[model samples]
Target: MRLEELMNEHYDEFNENDLHILKYVLNHKATSSQMSINQLAEACHTSRSSVHRLTKKLNFAGYSEFKVFLKWESQPAEQESRHTEILTNDIEATMKNLADTNFELLSNKLVSARRIFIYGSGTAQLTCATEAQRLFAVVNTFVTIIHDQVEFETMFPSMSDEDIIIIVSLSGDTPALLPQARKLNAKGIEFISITNLKNNKLAQLSPAAIYVTSSPTATEKGAGLASFIPFHIAIETLIRHFAEYLNV
Candidate 1:
């Protein structure tokens, strides 16, 4: 959560001095990262100790850690200002990430599976359904999408070692989907994931995952769901390679 939200959530917990320090830090968020502890204390008309205490209240180790949050909050504006530069850099970085990905391994997995099941939710489901349908049409692959826990569990009796599951999540922290991922893990059913570049839970849990360079300019919200283009590209890459292996 952002510091502003944090402050609002725990508004009553802070004393007047604490509120002063928090207001100063939040008001000067763009430059707060550069401000020294003493400077912040002086600006807030509080002592360094009060500033230190305020950081602790915010769950940061100290002013330094708090400043890091400030810096992160400030970065998006500067990044967005250089739109063309950011786009070029992100594309170049994404290309490098894609180049480093082992598509051959993914292709091999698909080739060996008797059935392919795709799992995605919300915006991601669109990618899953489209790719599943495309692969089925072009190569006659037996592909299906699992939309919910009920559907997934319903198919579990039919799923076997010869089958493969693919889960796509930008954050890899989908609350409803993670339990199912874990259950599949226990049954020794390996799966693939397409997620963010981070070492997210879904990426670590899956046997294989495709990483995409993190960029959010594409989304109206500029959040986790922002990079559909990257996911779309990665999905298409796998489909194209899988089709080639099937000689379709």
Candidate 2:
């Protein structure tokens, strides 16, 4: 995973000091990568132990690995004109997967469930889920959207085996969602997932999953612009297939 991904996965665990240190490192990647742990702590106006703890929270083996990661991220990106072409290929592949996927089980579950709830791990993912809700509503299959953590927690206890959940997540390994996934699993609740990658925790926990392939275009500074267009395509495909299944 990239630094941004790591951060996203463990973001809820970070404190204000950790964020401050992260901001400093992000802004001074080249310089910080070469600094010793003590040096970085001094520069960030924090203690060495605090810096080490932050590295661990990011899932780095140690400060050494963290430094290596910083060094890797600081390297200049190579320009690729084929980025657009690659994304097109990725979308085509995702569409093929969608067509080939057997959605019968999911369709049955959706049709039989007493209630259908949908949630997303982030803002963009929530937008995709909203689109899905809109599509389902077209068929009069009213789906509930869990807008945030507070709502999710409040509504979770009311969930039963007769209900089904749809989770939209980019990484599928988001920290905030893992506990909920585990709890859902323990309760034998049925849930499906839509994520960028298939081999992630959320997908593993799900009885059904839709995987979308997305390639991030790298900027000169090594930051990436990952297109979520494939997510929308997958959503539309699933909803259309379900609509056909409903013979609507």
TM-scores vs. true structure, each candidate? 0.61, 0.66
Stretches off by above 4 angstroms in model 1 are 1-78, 82-89, 217-225
> How well is each residue in 1-248 modelled by candidate 1, as lDDT tens digits?
44644564355568998877766766677777889999888887879998898888878898889888888877754445554666666666566667766787888898888888888756565565667667666776767878767888899877787888988887777787788888888887879887766535677577776776656554446643254666777777778877776777
Predicted candidate 2 versus true structure: per-residue lDDT over 5-36, tens digit per residue: 45545766889999899889878989999999
Candidate 2, residue 14: how far the Cα is off, in Å = 32
lDDT of the candidates, in the order given: 0.73, 0.84
Best by lDDT: 2
Error of 1 at 243 (Å): 2.3
Best by TM-score: 2
- Model 2 residue 193 lDDT score: 84
- What C-alpha RMSD separates each model from the true structure? 9.9, 9.3
